[model samples]
Target: MPEHGHKTPHLQEHLLNIPVPDYAPELRQLVFDYTLQLADTSLILGHRLSEWCGHGPILEQDLAMANIALDLIGETRSLYQYAATLEGKGRTEDDLAYLRSAVEYKNPLLVEQPNGDFGDTVMRQFLFDGFHYFLLKALKHSSDQGLSAIAAKSFKEASYHIKWSSEWVIRLGDGTEESKHRMEKAVGNLWMYSGELFMMTDTEKQLLEAGILPDYTSIKQQWDEHVAKVFSEATLEVPQQVYMQQGGKMGKHSEHLGYILTELQYLQRTYPGLEW
Candidate 1:
């Protein structure tokens, strides 16, 4: 049990009491919508990574990937559980995650990409972790204690995540010609979708005004510096992609989320109210 007088359920200890905006119903919905978007991205990404359970390059790599996926899943559970509590409409995390239609998810398209090769996986994490690190750092100051506590605690884990991933990025980039080529290609493919993660909506604006959330614009600058530093260390060049894809925060998602949902919600869809 943690010092909070309850047994910490994995990542549950981080659910602190950061005050959110006291907006009326409509504004509350907006803030929740934004928060859910962040949650969904990590949730979906964790699902995708979980698929690599048995097929990792080696046992160590497999365990490493699985551990990372577990961390993401842990983070997702905390975020979703808190979001449900805020909803105050008798909704559960399972209900929000499984019962929602595909159009209701706000996960970015980047997370839905098929995990092709180890290089692809590493490149994807590299891109996303850079952004997540900054977002969580900014979130530590969120007026919402729940989110700020989650961020403060998770930020430590995310730092390790960034370290582990950056090590792989550097190794693959400088290891051999084959690895270098594969990583380079993976970076190119993933770079186009990177911009959407930082794009904020009106809900975010309200949260920022009410001090419920951090300013994403400032976080973007820090993200750029961090990414640039990691890329340089990895001997990789940041792609100068001209076009950027957007629109996942508004319950918009990629084609892959539907397939992911089919599998994720299968048990719940098949047996309503069933639990272990």
Candidate 2:
């Protein structure tokens, strides 16, 4: 939060600190789309965790969720700032974040899904963090220097995030009867959305061709191995057969996103150009 009546430093000044290298003009749109995808996922999931700020099961866990939310929102700001630079449209990161229609956001379906109970939220975060931890590691090797830099910085936070969430998943899932029941319900609620993370669009395909990203197969392998190990410890059953939802990466989203944006964009939409 900003102090009343004191001007905060401009966001663009911070963005200037990021070192983006020269790239072919053909790569501009590709990078913009890819960066937006990453930013949107982080932003939506950050917002979801923020809903837990004062509502966690305990005080320490409350602070933990807040810190993780801040970590994700921090990553989102860098990615959105980078995407705005790529667009060359005079759009600021605020504009990209606040003014876009829900249809324009490229976050995966898994991220934008609502955070349910504490157990549900933990499951959601663990599943997404599992994928995110590996994806950032892969992105650190990108041909695009800017993406690589952002991924490297974000990967540090992600490592802790996964550890935190997975520990909770195990603690709850392997706990007493009621706790284990909630964890099982959470797995059923969120597992279907997990598969969409691996589904690729043309933007991902183009980036893969240019070595800006690794195959989703590889990331999925790492995610599956880690998830399986944790689940075994937790005594939770992995879903056997499931139909996966798709299309959020390419702007087709669940019904939930429209409602999320209504609240998320309300402050900016009501008071355009106002910032703390």
Candidate 3:
């Protein structure tokens, strides 16, 4: 029997059984919260990256970034699909992605930050991609089959994302003196926000203990090593800033996400569940 009274018809036939462990209500809430945030993060970031479809610094880079954007979007769809299942709602992935307000979104502010220049975009991606790679590595063993499968596939994709973003980081950081300076500033600007990626709440603790997920702290070490190596190769200095923005995990987003959501949700809101 499915635990927690959660029926997973479409999922059960395709996945192995993963029994839910004993946990307090708060811990379960945390799991749901974390999962929601993960999905929202991918969705919002994918949308932002898609903005660069034709505006890349070069045709090759433009295409590369666009390809990455497509992957993120695809990943976002998978995540939201699973999240809807977890929520036990009939809502489709499109409903969650297109209809949510900014305050309802759980994506970190870093991914939504403006893309100032090629260096800035690469720097943002470098930081986020590094963290994503590490997170997916741990998620590959999740007790939740839907979540685990998504992470397993995403892990492979993230390898490429890490490679692609890291290459750009190095190219801009070590290319021209101007490029290096810009890349350095981008890193500094984005550094403060990196801490949020590894912050653990009670939900994560429970998941880790249940052998459903890996500890974020353990993954942090690997993330740091990978990021440091890339920055070293790029000839960029990592910033030492400690003060950073927060509240993304709690559905508090920057002002930009509102505008973006407005644009994205316009047709959906006006049409009220109309589909082609």
Candidate 4:
């Protein structure tokens, strides 16, 4: 489930890892918050995907899930390293990844939802991938060259994620009667979580204005259109007018995050300083 060990050579490990004063103090803090959120989201989802590493329903998908989990974790590492640099707090990526409290994690509640079943996992991935695809596309043009580089690197992976997840959604939605029913259940159970992906906080709004991130409204539109197109082909209904969950960006989370943090932080907490 874990990616690189908690320890790695800091940002200096990469030629492109250099951090520049790309914004004023206030904006720099905003960028740090945003970057940390991105890292946290990927790390938690990556861990969830990793649970399927040896337990995939089929051999092919098992391997694929592991790879995708690795991709997200890899991206998480880069984002964390960048975040540590921006923090200027003498913290390493390991500290930032493993030392944070439950409320300190900034991932949306959606990603933290337990992976109930294969159908549920697929639905979760598809919903996130849909948004991720467009977010990366916009980030590729970020005025901050460092962020742009990371987004450009991640764009292809996000593209493949949506393609893979979309196929499963279609297959499950349009497959056998049992498969379709399970998929429908997955859709209903997960749809509400989808709204939080686009619910931006003041930090994100500022970043959008600074050209560091894209507008959530526009991203949500693209996400909705893509989801509707896919769900329609799958013979599924895209839920509308649902109550949206918020507060992840503000550090409030569902109960699930506490459990995740306990397990995730165990190795570090037990050891205190070194990477195990």
Which portions of model 3 miss their true places by more than 4 Å?
1-30
Q: For model 3, where is the 10-residue window of minimal lDDT?
A: 11-20
Candidate 4's C-alpha lDDT? 0.88
* Two-way lDDT contest, 1 vs 3, winner: 1
Give the Å error, residue 106, model 3.
Answer: 0.9
Give the per-residue lDDT digits (tens) of candidate 4, residues 1-276.
557666655544443565566578898899889999999999999988998988999999999989999889888988888888888889988899898898889999889888888999999999999998999899889887767888898899999999999999999999999999999999888888898899888889888887778888899899989999999999998887888877776789999888888888888888898642
lDDT per residue (tens digit) for residues 89-186 in model 3: 68777888888778888788888888888888888888899889988987888766666788988889899999998998888888998998898789
C-alpha lDDT values of all predictions: 0.81, 0.90, 0.78, 0.88
Candidates in order: C-alpha RMSD to true structure: 3.6, 3.3, 7.5, 4.2
**Please, what is the TM-score per model?**
0.90, 0.93, 0.87, 0.93
Candidate 4 local Cα displacement, residue 220, angstroms: 1.0
Runs in model 4 deviating more than 4 A are 1-15
* Order by TM-score, highest first: 2, 4, 1, 3
lDDT, residue 262, model 1 = 97
The residue-level lDDT of candidate 3 at 105 comes to: 84
